[model samples]
Target: MKATLILVGTELLSGGMIDTNSLYMAEELNKYGIEIGSKITVKDKIEDIINAITYGKENSDLIIMSGGLGPTIDDITKEAIAKYLNKKLVVDQDELNELKEKFRERNLKFIEINTKEVEKPEGSVTFKNGAGMAPAVYIDGIVCFPGVPIELYDMFPKFLKWYSEEKKLKSDEILIKDLITYGIAESLLDNKISDIFTEEGIDYEFLVKDFGIIIRLQSKISNKNIVEKIVEKIYNRVGDNIFGEDSDRLEKLIIKSLKEKGKTLSVAESCTGGLLSDSFVNVSGASEVFMEGIVTYSNDAKIKRLGVKKETLEKFGAVSEETAREMVLGLKTDVGISVTGIAGPLGGTKEKPVGLVYMGIRNGNEVEVEKKVFKGSRRKVRERAVLHSLFCLNKMLKRK
Candidate 1:
């Protein structure tokens, strides 16, 4: 099956707001073996929306639209869809009552303007919005969702369930898996698995994320063994670089590995601030393995808190391997990780440059420090440093 997505919002066109709903919808549809042929983004203008709808109706089997479904005057998606489909706008009494009840439960006044949320095209199937007041509308093959992400997320499942039961869409049994890897460049990875990617009935997508690179493998064949064999072939070629699959996060994996081994970790940060610590702490049950995290940004703080000598700071500066090693050594844990870097638009010397980072990991009596120069803005540099530190820590833990 083929689908087209129309995202309607002036804010999205003006770069004031990002359109992430289309991505979610595309992924969801692809899971059902539906291919997205086109994605259109239009302003809140009714004319533009109508044009997009006309185009979608002519070219696509299923049209999904998101945005401009609100109480505000600029919310014209329902009107545009009604005009395109030659259907009259009618107020859904049940939806209107639900909206009114929601407002009354929250002790908020329900003005007449709020009634717009319950208005739908004639003969359209309306889905309840669990997250907000705006109801989702489906007419013919077209589906409309609220601009709000939370509302769309909540309503989409119900819509999908209804469509599945009503249409009885056959599943193609398409399967997609994301194999996440770090500490390797995309070029090298592609070169290593270049031959395997060309195999029939399979597709590959290489996405560079903030944490690492993700290799998405999709299998058209329904057989589980065939998919596993294809995955095992890719694994045999580049298994060492693969960390986890699908939604597995590097920090969560590290925490899980540490907990499994009954090990604890401590961290000291300089240029990355508390980002590394924040990543680790975001995982549930991290307190079982995470002992402490210290952000020693200043030389005095490094000396006082992490036991870095004043002489070491004077000779090697804060963004040095020596300083990173000392910072890690200061913390007492089964594993100690430290990051020191120059993530800067300024504060770079002739010898030391911006994006220069030093990460140190102390495991038992063994200590390892790696120096790298990343390229990006200050925020990007710090993020890369933190991710690299986690990658190093993961490797060290795996070795132990």
Candidate 2:
């Protein structure tokens, strides 16, 4: 089914904020096999909002409108929908009492703002306000929701069932799995896997980037069983190199890998400066596999913590392959991963250029070190170093 998205905010139109809500909704709708035909943004004006709804009704099977649903004078989404549908705005007694009750329970003063929230367009279905004061409104195939991220997240997912019941949206089946890979461009992965898709006739897509790759697959069919079978068939073929599945990041994958393999990890960071450690520890169960992390940004700290040789720092500087190797191997953890680099606008000589990075991984008695030169701004350089460290560590983890 075709859909339209209308975002209302002067701030968004003037580039004061990015319109990420539309981006998120578009992708979510696509997963339901519902194509978005048009998207537009307007100021918090009644006529503009009404015109957008009018246009959407004429063109699309469904329309989703966000913003202008807050409890303020500028909150006009409900009013605009009422005008477009030629309906009266009447207070729903149930919702009005709810607002007052919540205020009373919290010992806060209630105002006309509470009454304003219950003013629904005539003959509109008011979806419950689990996440916010602004209740969702559904009228004539149009679903309007609040702009708040938390509220939208809670409310929009329920739209799947709502649409299926109300609009008779077909439950088209698609099973998707993602594998995150690095050290490759989107074009290159497409080159490697494009031929497979052609020969097998199994639909697949690649989300490629300098950060990493996420290979996704979904059957262009309506049967859940058949769609899932193709996903399994494809996964078996792309096995070990598939570090992550279903958009899980390197940290989550590593944690799972370590947990399954009964191994543990540690980090020694210089240029990456504990980013690697943070990535792992962010996951809920990472403590099961993450032993510790050491941020040795200085040469003296590296020597003291990871036992890098004082002479190595004097001869090759802090950002060198030799130093990285020493740092990784010298770590007391079972698996020691390290990164050292010149993430810089300054601090580079002719011999040691900016964006020069060295990464090291130590497993048992073996130490592997690799060096590369990245070109970017200071922050960009740091980001690249952190990404590369994760990528390399991911590969090594798989090999073990």
Q: Best-fitting candidate, measured by lDDT?
A: 1
lDDT of each: 0.88, 0.79
Against the true structure, what is each candidate's TM-score? 0.93, 0.86
lDDT score for candidate 2 against the true structure: 0.79
* Prediction 1 TM-score vs. true: 0.93
Error of 1 at 93 (Å): 3.1
* Per-candidate clashes, comma-separated: 0, 1
Superposed Cα deviation of residue 226, candidate 2 (Å)? 9.1
Residue-wise C-alpha lDDT for candidate 1, range 1-400, written one tens digit per residue: 7888999999998989988898788777767777899999999999999999889989988889999889898999999999988889999777788899999998999999999989999999888888888889999999999989999889887887788777776555778888898888999999888787656777888989887899988876465566687689878988888888988988999999989999889999999989989999999999999998999999999999989999999998888989999999999898889999889989887789888999998888889999999899999999998888888878888887
C-alpha lDDT (0 to 100) for residue 145 of candidate 2: 86
Error of 1 at 59 (Å): 1.8
Candidate 1: worst-modelled 10 consecutive residues by lDDT:
220-229
